[model samples]
Target chain A: MAEQVTRKPYVREVPRMLWFLRHPRYMRYMAREFSCLFIGAYTLMLVVGLKRLAEGPDAWAGFLAALGSPGAIVFHLFALAFSAYHSITWFRLTPKAMPVQIGDTFVADRVISGAHYAGWALVSLVVLWLAGAF
Target chain B: MATSNKPIVWGPFAAGGTLTAFLTPVLILLTLLAGLGHAPDLLAYDALRAFAAHGIVKLGLVVVIFLSLWSAAHRLRITCYDLGLRADTLVATLVYAVAIAGTVAAAAYLLRLNPV
Candidate 1:
Protein backbone atom coordinates (compact mmCIF):
# COMPACT_ATOMS: atom_id res chain seq x y z
CA MET A 1 0.00 0.00 0.00
CA ALA A 2 1.26 3.53 -0.85
CA GLU A 3 1.86 6.03 1.92
CA GLN A 4 -1.13 8.34 2.52
CA VAL A 5 -0.50 11.98 1.67
CA THR A 6 -2.49 14.94 2.99
CA ARG A 7 -2.90 18.17 1.07
CA LYS A 8 -4.42 21.50 2.04
CA PRO A 9 -5.99 23.70 -0.60
CA TYR A 10 -6.03 27.46 -0.26
CA VAL A 11 -9.49 28.94 -0.49
CA ARG A 12 -10.28 32.63 -0.57
CA GLU A 13 -13.41 33.59 1.29
CA VAL A 14 -15.64 35.86 -0.78
CA PRO A 15 -18.04 38.19 0.94
CA ARG A 16 -21.20 36.74 -0.45
CA MET A 17 -23.47 39.72 0.10
CA LEU A 18 -21.04 42.28 -1.27
CA TRP A 19 -19.31 40.29 -3.99
CA PHE A 20 -21.63 41.65 -6.66
CA LEU A 21 -20.80 45.17 -5.61
CA ARG A 22 -17.23 44.69 -6.84
CA HIS A 23 -18.26 44.60 -10.50
CA PRO A 24 -20.64 46.66 -12.60
CA ARG A 25 -21.57 43.60 -14.67
CA TYR A 26 -22.48 41.73 -11.53
CA MET A 27 -24.60 44.67 -10.39
CA ARG A 28 -26.43 44.69 -13.72
CA TYR A 29 -26.95 40.96 -13.44
CA MET A 30 -28.37 41.39 -9.98
CA ALA A 31 -30.74 44.08 -11.28
CA ARG A 32 -31.98 41.71 -13.99
CA GLU A 33 -32.58 38.99 -11.43
CA PHE A 34 -34.27 41.46 -9.10
CA SER A 35 -36.82 42.38 -11.76
CA CYS A 36 -38.60 39.14 -10.97
CA LEU A 37 -39.73 40.59 -7.67
CA PHE A 38 -41.68 43.33 -9.39
CA ILE A 39 -42.93 40.97 -12.06
CA GLY A 40 -44.15 38.47 -9.49
CA ALA A 41 -45.81 41.11 -7.35
CA TYR A 42 -47.55 42.53 -10.42
CA THR A 43 -48.87 39.08 -11.26
CA LEU A 44 -50.13 38.69 -7.72
CA MET A 45 -51.92 42.01 -8.09
CA LEU A 46 -53.60 40.63 -11.19
CA VAL A 47 -54.66 37.63 -9.18
CA VAL A 48 -56.17 39.98 -6.63
CA GLY A 49 -57.97 41.78 -9.41
CA LEU A 50 -59.35 38.49 -10.63
CA LYS A 51 -60.66 37.80 -7.18
CA ARG A 52 -62.31 41.19 -7.09
CA LEU A 53 -63.90 40.55 -10.46
CA ALA A 54 -65.23 37.28 -9.17
CA GLU A 55 -66.74 39.08 -6.21
CA GLY A 56 -69.06 41.10 -8.55
CA PRO A 57 -69.30 44.61 -10.00
CA ASP A 58 -69.03 46.49 -6.75
CA ALA A 59 -65.89 44.67 -5.76
CA TRP A 60 -64.35 45.06 -9.18
CA ALA A 61 -65.09 48.75 -9.13
CA GLY A 62 -63.59 49.05 -5.70
CA PHE A 63 -60.47 47.32 -6.88
CA LEU A 64 -60.12 49.75 -9.77
CA ALA A 65 -60.75 52.65 -7.46
CA ALA A 66 -58.04 51.43 -5.20
CA LEU A 67 -55.65 51.18 -8.10
CA GLY A 68 -56.30 54.84 -8.88
CA SER A 69 -54.42 55.90 -5.80
CA PRO A 70 -51.15 57.78 -6.17
CA GLY A 71 -49.27 55.02 -4.39
CA ALA A 72 -50.56 52.35 -6.74
CA ILE A 73 -49.69 54.43 -9.78
CA VAL A 74 -46.15 54.88 -8.49
CA PHE A 75 -45.89 51.17 -7.83
CA HIS A 76 -47.02 50.39 -11.35
CA LEU A 77 -44.55 52.87 -12.80
CA PHE A 78 -41.68 51.16 -10.99
CA ALA A 79 -42.90 47.72 -11.96
CA LEU A 80 -43.13 48.72 -15.59
CA ALA A 81 -39.58 50.05 -15.57
CA PHE A 82 -38.21 46.89 -13.97
CA SER A 83 -40.27 44.65 -16.24
CA ALA A 84 -39.04 46.45 -19.34
CA TYR A 85 -35.47 46.01 -18.13
CA HIS A 86 -36.13 42.33 -17.63
CA SER A 87 -37.52 42.04 -21.15
CA ILE A 88 -34.50 43.71 -22.72
CA THR A 89 -32.02 41.54 -20.84
CA TRP A 90 -34.01 38.40 -21.49
CA PHE A 91 -34.10 39.04 -25.23
CA ARG A 92 -30.41 39.82 -25.25
CA LEU A 93 -29.64 36.46 -23.63
CA THR A 94 -31.98 34.26 -25.69
CA PRO A 95 -29.70 33.57 -28.66
CA LYS A 96 -27.19 31.91 -26.33
CA ALA A 97 -29.80 29.58 -24.88
CA MET A 98 -31.32 28.63 -28.25
CA PRO A 99 -29.14 28.35 -31.28
CA VAL A 100 -30.83 27.60 -34.55
CA GLN A 101 -28.86 25.68 -37.17
CA ILE A 102 -29.57 25.15 -40.83
CA GLY A 103 -27.34 23.30 -43.25
CA ASP A 104 -24.33 23.27 -40.86
CA THR A 105 -24.60 27.00 -40.22
CA PHE A 106 -25.91 28.46 -36.98
CA VAL A 107 -28.25 31.42 -37.16
CA ALA A 108 -26.78 34.83 -36.32
CA ASP A 109 -27.33 36.22 -32.85
CA ARG A 110 -28.85 39.47 -34.14
CA VAL A 111 -31.30 37.53 -36.28
CA ILE A 112 -32.41 35.44 -33.33
CA SER A 113 -32.80 38.39 -30.97
CA GLY A 114 -34.30 40.56 -33.70
CA ALA A 115 -36.93 37.93 -34.26
CA HIS A 116 -37.79 38.18 -30.59
CA TYR A 117 -38.14 41.95 -30.90
CA ALA A 118 -40.42 41.50 -33.89
CA GLY A 119 -42.53 38.99 -32.02
CA TRP A 120 -42.70 41.31 -29.04
CA ALA A 121 -43.94 44.15 -31.23
CA LEU A 122 -46.56 41.92 -32.83
CA VAL A 123 -47.77 40.66 -29.46
CA SER A 124 -47.93 44.16 -28.08
CA LEU A 125 -50.01 45.26 -31.07
CA VAL A 126 -52.38 42.37 -30.56
CA VAL A 127 -52.75 43.10 -26.87
CA LEU A 128 -53.32 46.78 -27.56
CA TRP A 129 -55.86 45.95 -30.24
CA LEU A 130 -57.65 43.60 -27.91
CA ALA A 131 -57.69 46.34 -25.30
CA GLY A 132 -59.31 48.62 -27.90
CA ALA A 133 -56.23 50.79 -28.33
CA PHE A 134 -56.94 50.93 -32.07
CA MET B 1 -25.75 10.32 -6.40
CA ALA B 2 -29.41 11.29 -6.62
CA THR B 3 -30.74 12.79 -9.80
CA SER B 4 -31.34 16.50 -9.55
CA ASN B 5 -34.92 17.77 -9.89
CA LYS B 6 -33.70 21.18 -11.13
CA PRO B 7 -35.30 20.78 -14.53
CA ILE B 8 -38.82 20.72 -13.15
CA VAL B 9 -38.44 24.25 -11.84
CA TRP B 10 -36.15 25.33 -14.66
CA GLY B 11 -38.70 24.47 -17.34
CA PRO B 12 -41.32 26.85 -16.02
CA PHE B 13 -38.71 29.47 -15.21
CA ALA B 14 -37.60 29.57 -18.83
CA ALA B 15 -41.08 29.54 -20.31
CA GLY B 16 -42.42 32.11 -17.90
CA GLY B 17 -39.39 34.33 -18.38
CA THR B 18 -39.97 34.32 -22.12
CA LEU B 19 -43.66 35.02 -21.78
CA THR B 20 -43.06 37.82 -19.35
CA ALA B 21 -40.40 39.33 -21.57
CA PHE B 22 -42.89 39.51 -24.41
CA LEU B 23 -46.05 40.47 -22.55
CA THR B 24 -45.49 41.79 -19.03
CA PRO B 25 -44.50 45.33 -19.93
CA VAL B 26 -47.62 45.73 -22.01
CA LEU B 27 -49.81 44.31 -19.27
CA ILE B 28 -48.34 46.67 -16.69
CA LEU B 29 -48.90 49.58 -19.07
CA LEU B 30 -52.54 48.64 -19.37
CA THR B 31 -52.92 48.88 -15.61
CA LEU B 32 -51.15 52.22 -15.62
CA LEU B 33 -53.59 53.41 -18.24
CA ALA B 34 -56.50 52.22 -16.14
CA GLY B 35 -55.13 54.01 -13.12
CA LEU B 36 -54.97 57.20 -15.15
CA GLY B 37 -58.67 56.83 -16.06
CA HIS B 38 -57.82 56.16 -19.66
CA ALA B 39 -58.47 52.46 -19.83
CA PRO B 40 -59.37 51.22 -23.27
CA ASP B 41 -63.02 50.39 -23.77
CA LEU B 42 -62.28 46.69 -24.14
CA LEU B 43 -60.48 46.71 -20.81
CA ALA B 44 -63.31 48.43 -18.99
CA TYR B 45 -64.96 46.52 -16.16
CA ASP B 46 -67.92 45.02 -18.05
CA ALA B 47 -65.93 44.14 -21.15
CA LEU B 48 -63.14 42.64 -19.08
CA ARG B 49 -65.68 40.61 -17.13
CA ALA B 50 -67.20 39.33 -20.35
CA PHE B 51 -63.78 38.47 -21.68
CA ALA B 52 -62.82 36.59 -18.52
CA ALA B 53 -66.06 34.66 -18.66
CA HIS B 54 -64.89 32.90 -21.80
CA GLY B 55 -63.51 29.46 -21.02
CA ILE B 56 -60.49 29.80 -23.26
CA VAL B 57 -59.53 33.20 -21.90
CA LYS B 58 -59.90 31.97 -18.34
CA LEU B 59 -57.63 29.03 -19.08
CA GLY B 60 -55.09 31.28 -20.79
CA LEU B 61 -55.03 33.73 -17.90
CA VAL B 62 -54.54 30.96 -15.37
CA VAL B 63 -51.66 29.56 -17.37
CA VAL B 64 -50.04 32.96 -17.62
CA ILE B 65 -50.33 33.57 -13.91
CA PHE B 66 -49.01 30.11 -13.06
CA LEU B 67 -45.98 30.42 -15.30
CA SER B 68 -45.24 33.98 -14.21
CA LEU B 69 -45.43 33.08 -10.55
CA TRP B 70 -43.25 30.00 -10.94
CA SER B 71 -40.63 31.85 -12.94
CA ALA B 72 -40.41 34.61 -10.38
CA ALA B 73 -40.25 32.15 -7.52
CA HIS B 74 -37.38 30.19 -9.03
CA ARG B 75 -35.42 33.31 -9.89
CA LEU B 76 -36.00 34.70 -6.43
CA ARG B 77 -34.72 31.47 -4.95
CA ILE B 78 -31.51 31.78 -6.91
CA THR B 79 -31.22 35.42 -5.98
CA CYS B 80 -31.52 34.57 -2.30
CA TYR B 81 -28.75 32.03 -2.65
CA ASP B 82 -26.53 34.59 -4.31
CA LEU B 83 -27.24 37.06 -1.56
CA GLY B 84 -25.78 34.66 1.00
CA LEU B 85 -29.07 33.34 2.37
CA ARG B 86 -27.49 29.86 2.12
CA ALA B 87 -30.64 28.13 3.33
CA ASP B 88 -31.59 27.06 -0.16
CA THR B 89 -34.06 24.34 0.69
CA LEU B 90 -36.05 26.60 2.98
CA VAL B 91 -36.01 29.46 0.51
CA ALA B 92 -37.06 27.19 -2.32
CA THR B 93 -39.93 25.81 -0.29
CA LEU B 94 -41.20 29.25 0.70
CA VAL B 95 -41.03 30.78 -2.77
CA TYR B 96 -42.52 27.73 -4.51
CA ALA B 97 -45.31 27.55 -1.96
CA VAL B 98 -46.20 31.18 -2.64
CA ALA B 99 -46.17 30.51 -6.37
CA ILE B 100 -48.49 27.55 -5.98
CA ALA B 101 -50.86 29.49 -3.76
CA GLY B 102 -51.00 32.34 -6.29
CA THR B 103 -51.73 29.92 -9.12
CA VAL B 104 -54.48 28.15 -7.21
CA ALA B 105 -56.05 31.42 -6.16
CA ALA B 106 -56.04 32.74 -9.73
CA ALA B 107 -57.63 29.53 -11.00
CA ALA B 108 -60.31 29.55 -8.35
CA TYR B 109 -61.24 33.15 -9.09
CA LEU B 110 -61.32 32.60 -12.84
CA LEU B 111 -63.51 29.54 -12.45
CA ARG B 112 -66.10 31.48 -10.51
CA LEU B 113 -66.30 34.43 -12.90
CA ASN B 114 -69.55 34.17 -14.86
CA PRO B 115 -70.61 36.10 -17.97
CA VAL B 116 -73.55 38.40 -17.53
Candidate 2:
Protein backbone atom coordinates (compact mmCIF):
# COMPACT_ATOMS: atom_id res chain seq x y z
CA MET A 1 0.00 0.00 0.00
CA ALA A 2 1.44 3.45 -1.00
CA GLU A 3 1.25 6.35 1.51
CA GLN A 4 -1.07 9.18 0.42
CA VAL A 5 -0.03 12.88 0.76
CA THR A 6 -2.62 15.64 1.38
CA ARG A 7 -1.89 18.90 -0.41
CA LYS A 8 -2.86 22.26 1.12
CA PRO A 9 -3.99 25.32 -0.90
CA TYR A 10 -1.25 27.86 -1.64
CA VAL A 11 -1.72 31.35 -0.17
CA ARG A 12 0.54 34.20 -1.25
CA GLU A 13 1.51 36.89 1.24
CA VAL A 14 0.67 40.39 -0.02
CA PRO A 15 3.55 42.86 -0.15
CA ARG A 16 3.25 45.78 2.33
CA MET A 17 4.30 48.29 -0.35
CA LEU A 18 1.39 47.33 -2.63
CA TRP A 19 -1.34 46.88 -0.03
CA PHE A 20 -2.72 50.42 0.39
CA LEU A 21 -2.04 51.36 -3.23
CA ARG A 22 -4.01 48.32 -4.36
CA HIS A 23 -6.96 48.86 -2.04
CA PRO A 24 -9.61 51.47 -2.93
CA ARG A 25 -11.47 51.18 0.37
CA TYR A 26 -8.39 52.14 2.38
CA MET A 27 -7.91 55.21 0.20
CA ARG A 28 -11.48 56.30 0.82
CA TYR A 29 -11.11 55.73 4.55
CA MET A 30 -8.12 58.08 4.44
CA ALA A 31 -10.04 60.72 2.51
CA ARG A 32 -12.79 60.52 5.10
CA GLU A 33 -10.39 61.05 7.97
CA PHE A 34 -8.65 64.08 6.47
CA SER A 35 -11.97 65.93 6.11
CA CYS A 36 -12.11 66.55 9.83
CA LEU A 37 -9.67 69.49 9.69
CA PHE A 38 -12.12 71.69 7.83
CA ILE A 39 -14.84 70.54 10.18
CA GLY A 40 -12.85 71.74 13.19
CA ALA A 41 -12.07 75.12 11.65
CA TYR A 42 -15.69 75.74 10.71
CA THR A 43 -16.82 74.75 14.19
CA LEU A 44 -14.45 77.34 15.63
CA MET A 45 -16.01 79.99 13.44
CA LEU A 46 -19.47 79.14 14.76
CA VAL A 47 -18.17 79.18 18.29
CA VAL A 48 -16.79 82.66 17.65
CA GLY A 49 -20.21 83.74 16.46
CA LEU A 50 -21.78 82.29 19.59
CA LYS A 51 -19.29 84.04 21.80
CA ARG A 52 -19.94 87.34 20.02
CA LEU A 53 -23.64 86.90 20.63
CA ALA A 54 -22.93 86.32 24.27
CA GLU A 55 -20.87 89.51 24.44
CA GLY A 56 -23.58 91.97 23.23
CA PRO A 57 -25.18 93.51 20.09
CA ASP A 58 -22.25 95.67 19.01
CA ALA A 59 -19.92 92.71 19.28
CA TRP A 60 -22.34 90.58 17.28
CA ALA A 61 -22.53 93.31 14.65
CA GLY A 62 -18.76 93.47 14.56
CA PHE A 63 -18.63 89.72 14.03
CA LEU A 64 -21.12 89.86 11.15
CA ALA A 65 -19.26 92.83 9.74
CA ALA A 66 -16.07 90.84 9.84
CA LEU A 67 -17.85 87.98 8.14
CA GLY A 68 -18.75 90.25 5.21
CA SER A 69 -15.11 90.97 4.49
CA PRO A 70 -13.40 89.50 1.39
CA GLY A 71 -11.14 87.37 3.58
CA ALA A 72 -14.12 85.89 5.36
CA ILE A 73 -15.79 85.22 2.02
CA VAL A 74 -12.76 83.23 0.90
CA PHE A 75 -12.72 81.29 4.15
CA HIS A 76 -16.43 80.57 3.71
CA LEU A 77 -15.80 79.22 0.21
CA PHE A 78 -13.07 76.86 1.42
CA ALA A 79 -15.30 75.77 4.28
CA LEU A 80 -18.14 75.10 1.82
CA ALA A 81 -16.02 72.80 -0.34
CA PHE A 82 -14.89 70.70 2.58
CA SER A 83 -18.39 70.68 4.06
CA ALA A 84 -20.05 69.48 0.85
CA TYR A 85 -17.54 66.66 0.55
CA HIS A 86 -18.18 65.68 4.15
CA SER A 87 -21.97 65.66 3.76
CA ILE A 88 -21.98 63.53 0.61
CA THR A 89 -19.47 61.03 1.99
CA TRP A 90 -21.21 60.98 5.33
CA PHE A 91 -24.49 60.14 3.61
CA ARG A 92 -22.68 57.46 1.61
CA LEU A 93 -21.76 55.88 4.92
CA THR A 94 -25.31 56.15 6.26
CA PRO A 95 -26.27 52.67 5.16
CA LYS A 96 -23.52 51.27 7.30
CA ALA A 97 -24.34 53.51 10.25
CA MET A 98 -28.10 53.11 10.20
CA PRO A 99 -29.34 50.33 7.96
CA VAL A 100 -32.86 51.02 6.76
CA GLN A 101 -35.47 48.29 6.40
CA ILE A 102 -39.01 48.21 5.16
CA GLY A 103 -41.41 45.29 5.34
CA ASP A 104 -38.61 42.76 5.88
CA THR A 105 -36.61 44.23 3.00
CA PHE A 106 -33.33 46.14 3.35
CA VAL A 107 -33.00 49.44 1.50
CA ALA A 108 -29.96 50.05 -0.66
CA ASP A 109 -27.23 52.52 0.28
CA ARG A 110 -27.71 54.53 -2.92
CA VAL A 111 -31.37 54.99 -2.09
CA ILE A 112 -30.50 56.18 1.39
CA SER A 113 -27.95 58.67 0.04
CA GLY A 114 -30.40 59.91 -2.58
CA ALA A 115 -33.09 60.43 0.03
CA HIS A 116 -30.67 62.41 2.19
CA TYR A 117 -29.73 64.63 -0.73
CA ALA A 118 -33.37 65.24 -1.51
CA GLY A 119 -34.17 66.02 2.10
CA TRP A 120 -31.26 68.45 2.38
CA ALA A 121 -32.32 70.12 -0.86
CA LEU A 122 -35.83 70.61 0.44
CA VAL A 123 -34.56 71.98 3.71
CA SER A 124 -32.20 74.36 1.91
CA LEU A 125 -35.03 75.61 -0.23
CA VAL A 126 -37.25 76.13 2.75
CA VAL A 127 -34.53 77.97 4.63
CA LEU A 128 -33.77 80.20 1.68
CA TRP A 129 -37.43 81.02 1.20
CA LEU A 130 -37.80 81.84 4.89
CA ALA A 131 -34.75 84.08 4.65
CA GLY A 132 -36.43 85.87 1.71
CA ALA A 133 -33.69 84.79 -0.66
CA PHE A 134 -36.22 83.80 -3.29
CA MET B 1 -7.38 38.34 10.68
CA ALA B 2 -5.61 39.01 7.43
CA THR B 3 -8.28 41.47 6.36
CA SER B 4 -8.07 43.25 9.71
CA ASN B 5 -4.31 43.50 9.57
CA LYS B 6 -4.21 45.88 6.63
CA PRO B 7 -2.92 49.42 7.36
CA ILE B 8 -5.38 52.29 6.78
CA VAL B 9 -4.87 55.81 5.56
CA TRP B 10 -5.58 58.49 8.13
CA GLY B 11 -5.01 62.00 6.95
CA PRO B 12 -6.61 65.32 5.82
CA PHE B 13 -9.90 63.66 4.90
CA ALA B 14 -10.82 63.12 8.52
CA ALA B 15 -10.53 66.77 9.58
CA GLY B 16 -11.98 68.03 6.31
CA GLY B 17 -14.93 65.67 6.52
CA THR B 18 -15.93 66.73 9.99
CA LEU B 19 -15.63 70.44 9.19
CA THR B 20 -17.45 69.98 5.94
CA ALA B 21 -20.28 68.09 7.55
CA PHE B 22 -21.44 71.02 9.70
CA LEU B 23 -20.19 74.11 7.90
CA THR B 24 -20.76 73.48 4.19
CA PRO B 25 -24.38 74.60 3.96
CA VAL B 26 -23.88 77.63 6.10
CA LEU B 27 -20.93 78.63 3.94
CA ILE B 28 -22.99 78.28 0.80
CA LEU B 29 -25.72 80.51 2.17
CA LEU B 30 -23.15 83.05 3.25
CA THR B 31 -21.51 82.97 -0.16
CA LEU B 32 -24.78 83.48 -1.97
CA LEU B 33 -25.56 86.38 0.28
CA ALA B 34 -22.12 87.84 -0.35
CA GLY B 35 -22.48 87.37 -4.10
CA LEU B 36 -25.75 89.21 -4.01
CA GLY B 37 -23.77 92.15 -2.56
CA HIS B 38 -26.57 92.58 -0.10
CA ALA B 39 -24.70 92.83 3.11
CA PRO B 40 -27.69 92.92 5.40
CA ASP B 41 -27.60 95.08 8.48
CA LEU B 42 -25.64 93.41 11.19
CA LEU B 43 -27.78 91.29 13.50
CA ALA B 44 -28.79 93.57 16.33
CA TYR B 45 -26.72 92.83 19.41
CA ASP B 46 -29.70 93.86 21.51
CA ALA B 47 -31.74 91.08 19.91
CA LEU B 48 -29.17 88.43 20.83
CA ARG B 49 -28.74 90.04 24.23
CA ALA B 50 -32.49 90.01 24.63
CA PHE B 51 -32.73 86.35 23.72
CA ALA B 52 -29.91 85.51 26.07
CA ALA B 53 -31.58 87.61 28.66
CA HIS B 54 -34.87 85.80 28.06
CA GLY B 55 -33.42 82.26 27.88
CA ILE B 56 -34.57 81.21 24.36
CA VAL B 57 -31.33 82.11 22.58
CA LYS B 58 -29.45 80.63 25.49
CA LEU B 59 -31.26 77.32 24.97
CA GLY B 60 -30.76 77.42 21.21
CA LEU B 61 -27.09 78.27 21.67
CA VAL B 62 -26.66 75.42 24.09
CA VAL B 63 -28.28 72.93 21.73
CA VAL B 64 -26.07 73.99 18.82
CA ILE B 65 -22.96 73.88 20.98
CA PHE B 66 -23.66 70.39 22.28
CA LEU B 67 -24.65 68.90 18.92
CA SER B 68 -21.62 70.27 17.11
CA LEU B 69 -19.31 69.25 19.92
CA TRP B 70 -20.61 65.70 20.05
CA SER B 71 -20.43 65.30 16.29
CA ALA B 72 -16.81 66.49 16.27
CA ALA B 73 -15.93 64.22 19.17
CA HIS B 74 -17.41 61.20 17.39
CA ARG B 75 -15.50 61.99 14.22
CA LEU B 76 -12.28 62.46 16.17
CA ARG B 77 -12.79 59.05 17.76
CA ILE B 78 -12.99 57.40 14.34
CA THR B 79 -10.02 59.42 13.10
CA CYS B 80 -7.91 58.16 15.99
CA TYR B 81 -8.91 54.60 15.16
CA ASP B 82 -7.89 55.05 11.54
CA LEU B 83 -4.47 56.33 12.64
CA GLY B 84 -3.71 52.81 14.02
CA LEU B 85 -4.74 53.64 17.52
CA ARG B 86 -5.33 50.09 18.69
CA ALA B 87 -7.43 51.01 21.71
CA ASP B 88 -10.33 52.26 19.59
CA THR B 89 -13.04 51.05 21.93
CA LEU B 90 -11.42 52.84 24.84
CA VAL B 91 -10.94 56.05 22.84
CA ALA B 92 -14.54 55.97 21.65
CA THR B 93 -15.78 55.59 25.20
CA LEU B 94 -13.64 58.48 26.38
CA VAL B 95 -14.78 60.64 23.48
CA TYR B 96 -18.44 60.00 24.26
CA ALA B 97 -17.82 60.60 27.93
CA VAL B 98 -16.36 64.04 27.18
CA ALA B 99 -19.18 64.82 24.76
CA ILE B 100 -21.79 63.90 27.39
CA ALA B 101 -20.09 66.09 29.95
CA GLY B 102 -19.98 69.02 27.53
CA THR B 103 -23.61 68.44 26.62
CA VAL B 104 -24.65 68.33 30.24
CA ALA B 105 -22.77 71.56 30.91
CA ALA B 106 -24.52 73.17 27.93
CA ALA B 107 -27.92 72.09 29.22
CA ALA B 108 -27.18 73.21 32.73
CA TYR B 109 -26.08 76.64 31.54
CA LEU B 110 -29.25 76.96 29.49
CA LEU B 111 -31.59 75.85 32.25
CA ARG B 112 -30.39 78.38 34.76
CA LEU B 113 -33.12 80.99 35.27
CA ASN B 114 -30.81 83.79 36.26
CA PRO B 115 -29.18 85.81 33.49
CA VAL B 116 -26.22 88.12 33.97
Candidate closest to the true structure, highest TM-score: 1
Candidate 2 C-alpha error for residue B102, in Å: 7.3
Q: How close is candidate 1 to the true structure, as a TM-score?
A: 0.93
Clashing pairs in 1: none
Worst 10 residues of 2 chain B by lDDT: B5-14
lDDT of each: 0.92, 0.60
lDDT by residue (B1-116, candidate 1, tens digit) is: 98989899899999999999999999998888888888777667789999999999999999999999999999999999999999999999999999999999999999898767
Angstrom error at residue A36, model 2: 2.5
Global CA lDDT computed for model 2 = 0.60
The list of candidate 2 runs beyond 4 A from truth reads A1-27, A132-134, B1-24, B31-57, B84-116
TM-score of each: 0.93, 0.61
Candidate 2 residues A1-134, lDDT tens each? 59767788799876443344567987776666555555555555666666666555577667777877887778677766666667878877767877989999999889988887777667667655544455
